[model samples]
Target: MKLSKKSMTVLSFTLGACLFVSTAFADTLLGSGYDRLKDSAKNTATLMEKDLKNYTVEALYSLKDNDQTLLQASTFAKMDTVNQLSEENTVTKTAKGETTSSYSYSDKKLSVRKSGMDNTYYVTEYPADVNRKGPAEFSNPFKENGAAEIEKIVDAVVGSLKDYVQVEEGTDGGKVYSGSLSEAQVPAVVNAVSSFGIKQMLHDERDLPKIESDIFVKKVVGTAVENKAGYLENVTGDITLSGKDKNGVQHDLSLNVIVKLSEVGNTKIAMPDLTSAKVEKVSYSGGFSSKYVGTYKNDIIMDKDGKFEKIGERTVVITSVEGDKVTGKYSETVYPGFESEYPNKDAFNFEYNPATSSTFTYTDAKGEQKNGTIHPNSAGKVYFEMNIEVIDKNSWKSSSLKPYYDGEFRRIFE
Candidate 1:
């Protein structure tokens, strides 16, 4: 599965948040107590690397605007690496059963099928083809020694952060930790993450953007519960990022994650057979070009016009789709002046680089990409549901307008 930039950012945040707990380990954690925690983590890592382990995790992620839930979702995943197989299910509250996905993964390939909805099966090679193989492969942290390397980095980061953290025992026999690192403590974490000898597990060194002084973790809080056998039962945590976007809008991005593990050692995982499955080589072509238009009411009130617009219209143009490469353009124009009942207003063009435009990968309710016509109708239409980060070059500050367009383009010509 190819993660988009936003998804990658979330994954990076999860990895960075894991570093917070280590800060406490390097300092205020007691002698024997620290060893126990460290040993527990290490033992779990070793077992996962040597034996078989299964996990059932439920995660809820939300993005809010003015305390209102702009987006919220719950995900449940069951994975057993013994036979190298796993599956996941997800549901969103707003859409309820309307949008849900199921995924199955094996060592050699991955298959996705929409649950409670469609029949199209989206399949692809498991570990994407890359130059590196085995231990050297940097793609897919869930594969190879990737998991172990992350554990190593976590252990090392915790060990070296001793001087910068504070820890306390949880009331229920678990552990609680929190801290904000100083400028000098940042490198310790970096060095620790690099010490694992698994370079670029999270990101390539050269590709990593330069860190600013203000980019340090403002605050981190976490808790972990483990068994006497040095195995973790549950871990939960939240991290907050305080910063401003390119548009000068100050915002706080908060992420919460929960993990649970069980059935360690010699677990069985059954692999699925592709022989009987409806499998097709996914493909898109230029002949699929199309154009479409739709209309809606304008909700925004402009200052200069001091009027409520009656109508707003959107247009989409798909110039071409060559081979697996698809090209398209989108624009939404709103009549800011007096009532146009007929959408009689100036046209505001929102431009985007088609090459840079994110591909609109269609998945079933199960979230599996499949091969078929863009829309489920005879219209032969292409659709897009994307958050295109467009800048208003018409303005001096080049203000960012991350507009989201969800529409379909139907072929107007042959």
Candidate 2:
């Protein structure tokens, strides 16, 4: 798959950071070159490709002011190597809660479903070329076939290891390592990983974003605790980015992340029934006759002294129609030139009595009766001049004299 330059940079940075943490713990405690935990790391990788792994990750993003949470998300993922399937259920909580579930097959097709408390379900499909493996740091970084470039970077930094310090020893009899790097070291660290070289290795040609001019790492420090198997059990780090905004204002951003793992080689895995879900189609307005019984839109218009005036855009969705009767809903926005008004989308049901304009009763502000009119044009178009006098609840009325739909609208569904 072709990766974007930004994507490659991000991947390289992520790999570098993960390698820094994992390699620090392994090398300081067990020694490098896969001499200490090679068997354990390889065993884990082998099991990952043979069994199922379940992981839960929680991410919280907050602004610097009052630590106000801007967004919070939690994801539960299941991977079954034997069946070559993976699934992720993520619930993102911001102003409201939205859940997105996805299933991926090894052969490269993915099924995704999104459902929220305040919205209807939405689904989409992704072909193989657009999909990629996730959690890119589960394997050994110092292995010859692994992130060898990252290893070289770590080795290059060994001479500059004056900042390495012992954070603590865990109750599990494991040593925790911590280190800090100066801003000057950022370029060397980035260069050590050979981002361009890695892209060439992967056969990608995306141009990298210019990072030296505007963006640079201010400081980076991390602490990690390892498990009995010599694998990092938990790592916490903070990376600060110092840059300038569009307005030329100085800005500094810091990101604190915590990563952990669980349920390796034995995770409960299940796939949902995609056939039972409903599919909703959305597309730009196209020419749709009776064969396209869906939504349509047009600019609202007005009749003034035998002259038609364009006001705003109108969107109508026809659910169904039977024997001169039409039922559906419409939404509209008034143009800036119109008087003070509030836009609204409402439903309406009307029977088309071609001989005598469909007489629909509408209710006004004072509960007075109003008459709404429905006029059908040629085979592919229609118009509704809603009665502004009907006082009926079932009738649809607009705030202006140009009631329901202000002008003619053609079918746009295919």
TM-score of each: 0.45, 0.43
State the lDDT at 316 in candidate 1.
Answer: 51
For residues 93-136, write the lDDT of model 1, one tens digit per residue: 43122344545443434444444344545444433542212221
True-structure Cα RMSD, model 1: 13.1
User: Backbone clashes per model, in order?
Assistant: 8, 13
lDDT of 2 at 86: 57
lDDT of 2 at 251: 47
TM-score of 1: 0.45
lDDT of 2 by residue, 299-371 (tens): 7555434355676777767665543345565556677856433244334443333222324544534455556
The model with the greatest TM-score is: 1
